[model samples]
Target: MTQTSNRIFDEMARLMNDAAGVAQGVRREFDTLFRAQAEKMLRELEVVSREEFEAVKEMARLAREENEALKARIEALEGKTVAKASKKTKDSEPPTSAPEA
Candidate 1:
């Protein structure tokens, strides 16, 4: 009776090991399928590559920096022009004589 029980336990253990192996294989297959589907979806969605995204981001950053510099330059030039115009106006004005009461 003990011998029979031992044989049954051994058989059960073997079956469990086989089931574990099958589960692992199925998990691998599912992983592969999921990856393929994800890649296909990305392609369909027209997702850009990482490098392309980074390049566009960098371009935008550079453009912003250049715009800021140009704005500062324009402000400086306008300030100088305004100062020169005010000086000219002051120099061209004639002095008025005081009237006697």
Candidate 2:
């Protein structure tokens, strides 16, 4: 009778262990499925990756800097042209003089 009881208890313990293993496997599969679905959703939304965003941001920054530099150069050239025109006007003007005594 004692040996029979031991065999039954041993079988029960083995069954419980198998059930725990199966539960763990199901949990792992669920996690994998959830991750796959999330990735698919993000792709469908056309979300940019971090690397692509950073690259485009850097390009925009560089373009802004170039535009600013060009604006400064244009202003400097305009100033020089105005100064030259003023100088030419002064040179072309007749000099004023008092009548001789």
Candidate 3:
């Protein structure tokens, strides 16, 4: 009876050890597969990281503001030029002809 019990105990321990080893291997394989898939997805998406996106957004905003300011300046300059030209035309007009001779 004792021999039978000992054999059974040993068999159980061996099986348990094998199962633990298999579980560890499976965990490692899953981790490796998940990491590879994540990297592939990131590459395929062509998405910038948050920090890079934020930086680009800030640059675009600054460019837009600058463009608007430049446009306003150009409009102001054009208005001044137009006013000066109108004034010059008014000043240069000849007087109406006097009565004949």
Model 1: residues with Cα > 4 Å off, grouped in runs: 49-51
Flag the better candidate by lDDT, 1 or 3. Answer: 1
lDDT of 1 by residue, 5-99 (tens): 99999999999999999999999999999999999999999999999999999999999999999999999999999999999998999978899
TM-score ranking, high to low: 1, 2, 3
Each model's lDDT comes to 0.99, 0.98, 0.97
Residue 3 accuracy (lDDT) in model 2: 100
lDDT for 89 in candidate 2 is 97
lDDT of 3 by residue, 3-92 (tens): 999999999999999999999999999999999999899989987889999999999999999999999999999999999999999899
* TM-score list, all predictions: 0.80, 0.71, 0.59
What is the alpha-carbon lDDT for the whole of candidate 3? Answer: 0.97
Candidates sorted on lDDT, descending: 1, 2, 3
Show how many residue pairs clash in every candidate, following the order shown.
0, 0, 0
